[model samples]
Target: MTALDPFTDALDCPLYVVTATAAGERAGCLVGFASQCSIRPARFIVWLSKANRTYRVAARADRLAVHLLGHDQDHLARLFGGATGDMTDKFTRTAWHPGPGGVPVLDEAPVWVVGRVQSRFDGGDHCGFLLAPEAAQHPGGDGVRLMFLKDGPDISPGHPAD
Candidate 1:
């Protein structure tokens, strides 16, 4: 662990699911490394693991969708996080519809945003996708509890984190 672990370990931010479509193929995965990086003019970034199938698809995709999971939506998180897309068809197991640029938008998410890929930053074992909001769906949260990192440290990553 890096020196940042002391601070990072105590953190339990909300989890998210990111989906993308390219060349008629779709992919998505559980993401813990994403955040809004700008306020004025609005910008958000999603870091996709190089080992994830979604990352490969997103590399060729022009747009992507980011869905926020409610605290009680462990099943949704597990489905995205527990299995590799190489072996499982995640969309078939969940409710979703095509959104702008044909990105898959999760139906059960309380909030979701579709963004045009502004740029790509390839670094380390993951590439950061800089997104500019294109469209969004806000069903309006009524006590929508969000999912966090407390799902247990042993939670198997859909793909090995390496």
Candidate 2:
């Protein structure tokens, strides 16, 4: 048997800023564990850390927005990935508007998708939110976004989202 990290370590994946709103509160965090799991019905899944505030808010949220980070958007990545939302209102510093079901949509993101959570699964240290795509936008060219292990940019693990 082989440890998972040995295989996962070499995989390069895109980072996303997942946002959710519920009970008059908005929360978002940078996520690396997400993928499109189905094609016929077009389903996606994003795994949120159990320790983050985003997960807490998403627990009650019906919709979530996933933002695609561009190569030049490392600042947004840092803002969502490093700083803890417990202290700062990340919305005040960034440009965004309330989207479907009050989900916060980052205005700077060139590409984004809004999905309704179809199901939730407990994935040990994380909770997987299965999303059913409702809306999406592809407004830019192939500008490389941040990739784990590929860029390996200096970023803190993450802060809470709710």
Residues 1-162, model 1: lDDT tens digits = 899999999988778899999999999999888899999879999999999999999999999999989877878888899989999999999999999999999999998899999999987999999999999877675777677776523468888887
Please give the lDDT score at residue 106 for candidate 2.
Answer: 96
Best by lDDT: 1
Model 2: per-residue Cα lDDT over 4-92, one tens digit each: 97888788898889999999988898888999999989999999998888899999999999987876787888888887677668898
Clashes of 1: 5
Candidate 2 pairs with clashing backbones: 53-161, 53-162, 54-161, 54-162
Candidate 2 similarity to native, TM-score: 0.91
Query: What is the lDDT of every predicted structure here?
Result: 0.90, 0.85
What are the runs in model 2 whose C-alpha is more than 4 Å off? 140-149, 159-162
